[model samples]
Target: MRQMHGAWPKDALPHRIWDESYMELQHATRQHEFVTSLYVQAKLNTRALLDQVIPAYEGVFSDLYSATSLQVLRAVCKDKWMRRRL
Candidate 1:
């Protein structure tokens, strides 16, 4: 098992990296749009939306999640997973 101390980044690193990448994605708005549009345009497998949308949104959900401090997110995510399975 990897030692807890080995190369583990500081706590801030995750938030920092997340913020930077979000900014980068925002900058490359076209790529972001393409990925999203592709998902929609193809009428992706309903299961795809239910299983994958949260992960695709994972990169940006934290901010709004923090503000809301609600379980709706979990429910919504679970619904997606359920739809995918059904």
Candidate 2:
């Protein structure tokens, strides 16, 4: 034990290094959770806008819009198959 202690510098305790790493991991986890929450909120808002608001203009601009684009958006947003592709 004395030899081991002598091998490392005074400021370089293994326990202290482990504690600092643990603290850094905890901080990273909190940051990941915060970013994930923001992503969920943005996804929910986009879903709401796509599902509820865009349909209101469907009839008015039915002839002006491309059928293929509308179909692809509906598939990716509302259908399960395209969502799996995402």
Candidate 3:
């Protein structure tokens, strides 16, 4: 009985390691999925707002989210605002 009890911890070590590793993996996977969903939702909301604000935006820029397109939009808005002030 003493020998069996001493060997039990050795036998259980691998199982304990596997269980903890699996739980860690599950936590990481859930965090990744949550972040991905948030990104998708943000993209959808941006598209919806752009469509309402500038119906012809897509006709001008092949990639609406491109840096160049965004810069041009900022410049144009700034020009308009400046003209209004003048």
Name the top lDDT candidate: 3
Candidate with best TM-score: 3
Q: What lDDT is obtained when candidate 3 is compared to the true structure?
A: 0.82
Would you list the rank order by TM-score, best first? Answer: 3, 2, 1
Model 3 TM-score on a 0 to 1 scale: 0.61
Off by over 4 Å in 3: 1-18, 76-86
Model 2: lDDT equals 0.68
Residues 12-68, candidate 1: write the lDDT tens digits: 233344577787878799787888998776645643553464455544555433645
The residue-by-residue lDDT of candidate 3 on 1-86, one tens digit each, is 23455547534553444577899999999999999999999989977887887888878989877999889879978998999999
For model 3, the run of ten residues with the poorest summed lDDT: 1-10
TM-scores for the candidates: 0.23, 0.43, 0.61
Could you give candidate 2's per-residue lDDT for residues 1-86 as a string of tens digits?
Answer: 34445568665765544577899999999999999999989867755676585665445445323797567667656777666878
Which residue pairs does candidate 2 place in steric collision? none
Off by over 4 Å in 2: 1-18, 56-86
Candidate 2 vs 3: which has more TM-score: 3
Evaluate residue 63 in candidate 1 and report its C-alpha lDDT on the 0 to 100 scale.
Answer: 45
Candidate 2, residue 79: Cα displacement in angstroms equals: 25
